[model samples]
Target: MNHLGSHKLNNVLGQILLAKRMGKTRVIAETGAGQHGVATAASAAKFGMKTYALFSENDQVAPVYSISAGLAYPGVGPEHAFFKDSGRVEYVAATDDEAVDALLLLTRKEGILPAIESSHAIAEAVKRAPQLSKDNIIIVNVSGRGDKDVAAIADYLEKRNTKNQE
Candidate 1:
């Protein structure tokens, strides 16, 4: 099978070997650069599994609880910070409610359950969609899939509804 170019061994192997030799098992990377923790994920994936689970049941990483193990982090890289500093980009934060709603909308309307991470972008897109002209386009970059998040989504909605009813 062909490998993804992003999974280029050079980005990870040497570092992984060194981590292993040191008996260390965790790695952290940039967060919020994509406004979706993708910067963190790119580095995490490069180093391989660091979650509580030993083996992933599918292609993507296993489901994680909120505060999202690898994604809910602080700070941005210099390049991302520079863009923000220069006024080239406007970073937005989407709440879990917005993201979960967006995820359900995509699942029911478009038959796509995007990753919890990518849902942040979709949530922002939904908020901006009505404000834009009909000709305007909003493209959400879905960097990951949501197969692992189905259960998590269900749990989140259940807890939210229950909490709201209280």
Candidate 2:
């Protein structure tokens, strides 16, 4: 029921169907924690599109526990590599701190607890928002609920507080 959860599926379905209509058999995507990857794979499978996901090699960061349990990976889907070479999709990286900050900001402002993966997109948007004109429209996909991340976030904040006090 998260805001951007269905958007991912829709986007991937659109891409896969478009490529299929264009006679393309393969689809690829880049994901930080495999959320989009899983979605893309499912959609591609539905459309008979061969799917590949590209994942980051090093997901170790401040939220290592969440990353490891949720989306950390050493390799991406094979098709993602091919797409990267063909310029079909762009890859970007977000730091752990950026994600954490974005998560906090969105929670405080929008009252939404975004998944860590989705927080990366929010961080990117927050970075780009100030550079754009006031009338510019931006859409960010909030992929999932952050309920699962509550305990981890609490631990991280507690540690941060301890460090600040010391």
Candidate 3:
């Protein structure tokens, strides 16, 4: 199994564990690649809690493949299955913003904290999603250090700045 060591992953699990200890009934998470989604789902199953994972329509190809592999794992597949037989645990939204809204609605209705990895798309979703008064925790997965994203971020910022000035 290919393992990825990341502080972000650790922090996300810590938050989920803390929420579970607080008597939360469920956990909701949004993922782009299904990495975080599968991880959260596995963790929730370990704790005997129901897990709900949200995915955008543009989910990368790798995640679907990973999910299939995860399901193929022998003993791991039966008890702690990542993919549901009926696909009930997976919710697909038309857009990233819709995914965020669905997650937020789940949290508001179920009183569960949702963990969402931060991406350029999610930033937009956060802005467009409905206002949720209840406290919701969003976990952002930083794939590459900002050194790689700085150029893109700066370009976006400059464009927005120019738009605002005009």
Candidate 4:
């Protein structure tokens, strides 16, 4: 399937566009893996908007993801933080194991290998899908492909297998 390498870029661009439409001169955001920050900076530059990206110095989940699937990030986008605070978006943390499970499920079912970040979103959707009406549609942003995570996932699964056998 053809997909954006960093799907989150679309959101960042959309926010920038909205800010521009509203006559804002500056765009500020925070990012974890630098993807959103990079995307925001690029979009802002395109529109001649001043941009700032505040990255987190410490984030608990970043290290684990870095080791497990190489999807670690120090922080999320500031807009995401704002949405969480305003009740427009709910933030959920998925463990490496859960994300791996989601990755496997998606790969097996849809034949698509999703990035670790995208796996987190997929895992969240799996958790919420059962509660929603059948008519409801859930859209997940698959920010990137999992080609880079193949080795990491293999290592994770090998360790898991060893642990299960022991």
Candidate 2 lDDT, 1-166, residue by residue in tens: 4344544666666667677776777776656545666777787787777876655556422222344145564224434555676899777767777888999999999899998888888889999999999999999989799999888778877887898899
Regions of candidate 2 where Cα sits further than 4 Å from its true position = 1-68
Q: What is the per-residue lDDT of model 1 for residues 1-166, given as tens digits with 9 covering 90 to 100?
A: 3143333334444544555465555543332222223333444465563512122344344333342334654433333444554689898978889888888898899998789899888999999999999999888898879988878888888999999999
Instruction: Give the best candidate by lDDT.
Output: 4
For 9-112, candidate 3 gives per-residue lDDT tens digits of 55456646775776664666655455666666666676787776666566542433111121222112221233443365532223434433434454467554
The C-alpha TM-scores of every prediction are: 0.59, 0.57, 0.35, 0.59
The lDDT ranking, best first, is 4, 2, 1, 3
For residue 141, give model 1's deviation from the true position in Å: 0.4
Candidate 4 Cα RMSD (Å): 8.8
RMSD of each: 12.6, 9.6, 13.6, 8.8
Q: Output the worst ten-in-a-row residue range by lDDT, candidate 4.
A: 59-68
- Candidate 1 at residue 115, lDDT? 92
Number of the top TM-score candidate: 1
Order of candidate numbers by TM-score, starting with the best = 1, 4, 2, 3
For residue 48, model 3's alpha carbon misses the true position, in angstroms, by 0.9
| Candidate 2, position 131, lDDT | 100
